[model samples]
Target chain A: MIEIHDLHYRVGAAPILSDISLSLPEGSLTALIGPNGAGKSTLLRLMARLEPLQSGRITVEGLDLATTPTDAMARTLAIMGQQNSVASRLRVRELVGFGRWPHHQGRPRAADREAVEAAIDAFGLQPFAGRFLDELSGGQVQRAFLAMTFAQDTAWMLLDEPLNNLDVAHARALMARLAQLVQDTGRSVVAVVHEVNYAAAWADHVVAMKHGRIVAQGAAEAVLTEDLLSDLYDTPVEVSRHDGRPLVLHHHSHSRIADLSRGRLPDRARLS
Target chain B: MRFAAGLGLAALLALMLVSLGVGAAEISVRQARSDAWTMLVLMESRLPRTLAVALAGAALAVSGTLIQSLVRNRFVGPDTTGTSESAALGLLAVTILAPASPIWVKMVAASFAAMAGTALFIVVIRRLPRREVMLVPIAGLVLSGVLGSIVTWIAWQADLLQYVGVWMSGEFSGVTAGRYELLWVAGLAAGLAWVGADRFAILSLGDGVATGLGLSTASVMRFGLVVVAVVSALVVTTVGMVPFLGLVVPNIVARVMGDNLRASLPVVAASGAGLLLACDIIGRLLIAPYEMPVSVILGVLGALIFLVLLYRRPAHA
Candidate 1:
């Protein structure tokens, strides 16, 4: 389990994340959903220790983040952020091989090789294993980075906006793979998702944030209601069931207030 | 791997010997042995100068490779990092402040100053919120400019401008046996770097990756910087500042070869030696009795090569 308490992050005088406290249970897929400037990326970076926690306490399985060595934390948790601009000269296999670094420290053994190969196979990257990262498309590069994180083989995986540049089919495939990892392997995953439908369809737990604070969080079915999402995004929204999941309809032409005002016009409203 | 390195080593030796033999002096092998004075001049003057050039070239090249790897930047070098400039300032300080200071004292002072400059660069880089890697070399260039101006000002005030000019214009003319002994420090530094090549390569992956791999990023960076500073300082103290040998050689080697430090290190070293020696010979032959500085030749050639490299798009790795 990962726990964050009294998280207060400030960037030069303005508060980025204020009094944010949350706990992520073990063996679950939690999707962080929010609008722009919602601090989802900041929260993920803090959890990964990519940014220092200024006024908070974070612990993973009873080990305090401040006290645990980075290598030890890396062995337990792996993070892949949205910025995947790695030096393009590196080969796909070499990039994935870096995931084994925390274990072998560059002197890879047979087991490390096995893990790398497994990760490649898991991501269906065997065909492009020898290719350089520059040679691959954006979606293929995203998969390669995901394979690297998977190769780390940690208990916890944190992905920040993993679906940014991915096409529809690839995005669904990635979500399915993450869900399988959580369900079958009993590993935990936390991903910051921009598209709410992906979260509603796939996430076991949904966390909603606005202006750097969590507005709603719970089981997907409960927190993903129309009222909560409408309040969360400050826009009129309607939720309908699709394939036994909440399908958010937010792109309608008429506003809720406009519809209500027209309904009160009685027989004259039907003249048009 | 060891066998391949040995082959490279043999090649470097042959190049070194051939470079020593062929120079403007044109001393035939038989005549070199017949006259005692001629033998003495060749052995004492030409031999040490050649060896110093080779050692300085190799050291700077290796140091440049290490710096580039540690910073994960392509254009880094000892001069660009302000190391050689700071070292020159250190030497200048010693000459002005302590006129009676020994050569060893001056070398130590320069090494320490170079280390301090590198540490300052690292600190400045760490403090920036965005952590722009390009700023490192820029900061280094700024520091070099500042330190270089100070050195120049002091040298001018103290009437040591001639001495400073000689040191700044890198050449092999003044190198003799006693003066060239300082270059052994560079050799030792190169050896140390070679032994820690794996750690340096891991460091090229950035601090997070290196730290995640159980290596202390700060310690590794500090170690690599010290090695670069010490070697660069020693070379500057003995011969002078040899520009572009460090930057151009490593980049060319990495382009031709791969990023693997262990595999490319010797190639960088050899290429550095070969290029410097060829430049030195060209400098010697440019004028019959008088010769241009090796630094000038290297500077012009390096600029042309750099422009060519810039214009030519690199093929994807």
Candidate 2:
């Protein structure tokens, strides 16, 4: 389990996150969902130690995040941020093979090679293993990065907006893969998901943030309610049951454009 | 890849033979009458000159590769980044301050200056927006120009312009057994770069990914800075400045072998040595008896090749 206590982050006198405390359960998939400027990504970065702790304490699996050696921390958790621009022209196999760096440093043993190949197979990258990363499509490159994080083989995985540029099919496929990994291997995953339905469909736990504070967090069914989500995003929403889970519909039936077309619009101040 | 490396090595060996035979005094090794004279020439001048050329070539290329990795820019090299010019400035300062100082002291002083100059360049470029890739080398070139003018003005004031001029243009005519040993240290720096190739390759991916992968990016970058500074300083103090060997060699090698430095570093080093040796041989043969500096030929060819690189399809695609 990951524990956070009294976390406060600020940038140049502007507070980004304030007085936050949360504990994420082990062996479960958690989704962090929030509107823009809610500090969701900053919170995840802090938990992964990508950002230095300013005033908080975080512990992962009984190891203090502030003092643990980076290599040891790497074995405990793997975080993939939203950097899609790769500078070097590396082959997919070589890029995936770097995930074993913490284990082998520079010399790769046969076991490490086996793990790399296993990761490649897991991601269905055998056909493109020898190709350079720049040669592949956007979705394929996303999968390659995902395969690298998986090849790290840590107890916890953190992904920030993994579905940024992926198509609907690819996004659904990635969510399924993450769910299967959590179920079969009992590894923990925490992802920042924008689409609430994805969280509703797959996340075992959901965390909602607003104004740098945790608005609500609980089991998926308990926290994803019609009133809470509508208030969270400042838009009216309807929640219904689908396959024994909550499905949120937030797209408005009568949009402002429709009001404008029907000659029932208010002043431009309200529209702006 | 192995076949290409083998061919390069073979060609480099042939170039070394040609370099040894094409000096000013014609002493044939096949003639038994001047055997002692031939051996003396080979030992004192020919061998050291050839070896110095190869070592300086490899060191400059590796140094350039390290800088490119640290800066994450393809076009910046030691020549353009104020490294060589700063070293020349240091050499001038030491010459003017203590005319009787030993050569080793001068080399150390030059290395310190080069480190400072390169660090300033990094700090300057770090402020610019990263997506504008062309801004980096342009900044480096401007820094080089500023440092070059300072060195020239100081040299002119101190009545040391002739010495500084020799150091500005690279040549092998004055290289002998005892005078050209500093480049062996530069060669050692290249070997160190090879040993740390994996870290450099990882570093090129950027700070966030490298740290996520558990590398101490700060320490690795510091080590790289020291390597680049020392190599550039040694080359400048020994054989003067060799332009574009660093820039051209690494790009050509990457074009053929991609940017996996561990797989391509050895080839980069060999190709650097091979290209420089070929240039030196051409300079020697072009205007026999009255030699032209290798930098002139390299400058001309490097600019042409650099234009081609700029106009070609983006290598990222």
Report per-candidate DockQ. Answer: 0.25, 0.53
Give the TM-score of chain A, superposed on the true chain A, for all candidates in the order listed: 0.93, 0.92
Per-residue lDDT for A4 in model 2? 91
For model 1, residues A157-220, the per-residue Cα lDDT tens digits are 8898999898889898989888887898898999999999899989999989999999988889
lDDT of 2 at A133: 82
Top lDDT prediction, candidate number: 2
**Segments of candidate 1 deviating more than 4 angstroms:** A252-272, B1-11, B28-43, B120-142, B195-199, B211-215, B288-290, B313-317
Docking class of 1: acceptable
Give one digit per residue, the lDDT tens place, for model 1 in B12-61. 77766665666656676457777887687778887898888888888889
Interface RMSD after interface superposition, model 1: 3.3
Candidate 2: tens digits of C-alpha lDDT, residues B92-117: 99999998999999999999999999
